[model samples]
Target: MKATRLNLAPWLFLAPFLGIFCLFTVWPLLRSFILALQQTYGPGTTEWVGLHNFRYLLTDPLFWTAAANTGRFTLGSLFVQLPIALGLALLLNRPGLRGRGFFRLTFFAPSLVGLPFVAMLFAPILEKRTGLINATLHRLFPIWDPEFAWMQEYVMSSLILAALWMYAGFNMVYFLAALQNVSKDLIEAAEIDGANAWQRFRHVTLPEIAPIAGFVTLLSVIGSFQMFELSYILLNNTAGPENRGLTIMMYLYQSGFVVGDLGYASAIGWVLALTLMGIALFQRWAARRYEER
Candidate 1:
């Protein structure tokens, strides 16, 4: 009996977390999965319709559009955000850079701002007239039309720019940590072997931090897919002109709340979850293959 009690004590201590996790996270996920298999009209009004929601989703054009937008954002993060963060991290990691703390803080301040706040702040700044960005562009190049509607004309690009400003610093912090962990001795040995700066970084620093880089990439991809608040707040809760900025999450929100199709929304959520899981698995496999090579 004493041995059994001792064994149960650990679970006793873990009970709060386990209970909360089951009630909040696990339960909701399970409920959503079940809901996705049903047809919902209102609260407490649902009819089981197995596989119907999934079938409709596969045929839905809006679903495909949302997926494309999300894919674009994910690709932009990989191609644009990653390189910029790495470059800034490398620059700040230099041996004798002055006022490094201030520079880091300046760059990282945007990430500290809440997503809604960032969107609200940029809305006025990107406005056609009396906007900071247009005003500056007018001052810099008077030949060009200053009244260009950026959010309307370049919907995804505009969002990408805002995202770049918001997340570059966040990713830079990770890269900076990775850069610091790189051994100075290895770098010096590479230099002694007549390796150039790029060669040393390519051979020594990059390989050492590749795991962290991969982790950052995975996180960025997940965040891109989950983007809703920024576009919602920026585009005034409407998917931008032509639905260019419409993302899967935003569509899910609309279908579940606006259209009162809770079952459909739940289905969208599961599709997103499955897609993210597949991408994460692929990333893990790719990372392992790279390491082996």
Candidate 2:
């Protein structure tokens, strides 16, 4: 009985977490999948619709638009955010850097602010007439139009900028942590072998942090796909002019709550999940191929 109790102790301690995970995450996922196959007519009224929801999804132009916007945002995140974050991490990782701690805090503080807070803060800044952005641009380039509506005309670009401001530092923290784990001896050896700064980074430091880099890339992809709050709040819960800022999550929310099409929303949710899974799997496979090479 004592041996049995000892074996069960670990599970007993894990029970709370496991229970909450199932209740919140696993169960909702399963429920969504089920609902995706049905036609929801209210809270309690639902009829089995088989795969019609998915069939509709295949031809939905709005869905495609959302997918394209999401893809653009994800690509922008990879190209923009990762490079900046990694650069900052590398810069701050240099030996004897002054005020490293302060720099890290400064970069990371934006990420600590919630999405709603960020939206609220940037709203007035991006406004057409009295906004800071337009006013500054007008001062810097007097030829430029001072009445430019950034939030509407350049919706995706604006959203990307906001996302980068919030997440670049977060990724920097990851890269910094990864950089710390790189062996100093290896870097020194590379230096002694006449490898220049860029060469050293390309071979020694990069290989050491490849795994963490991959992880950060994965996280950025996921975060881009899950982008809703910032765009929603910033765009005033609308999809912006021509639905340019309509992410898959925003579309799903509109379908689920705004339009009262829970079944269709669940189907959209499944598609998003599947898309994320596919991209993640492909990324892993590519990383494996790179490692093998």
TM-score of each: 0.95, 0.94
Candidate with best TM-score: 1
Residues 143-241 of candidate 1: C-alpha lDDT, one tens digit per residue: 757788888887777788889999999999999999999999999999999999999989999999999999999999999999998888999989999
- Model 2 clashing-pair count: 0
- Cα displacement (angstroms), candidate 2, residue 188, comes to 2.3
Residue pairs clashing, model 1: none
Cα RMSD, each candidate: 1.5, 1.7
For model 1, what is the C-alpha lDDT against the true structure? 0.92
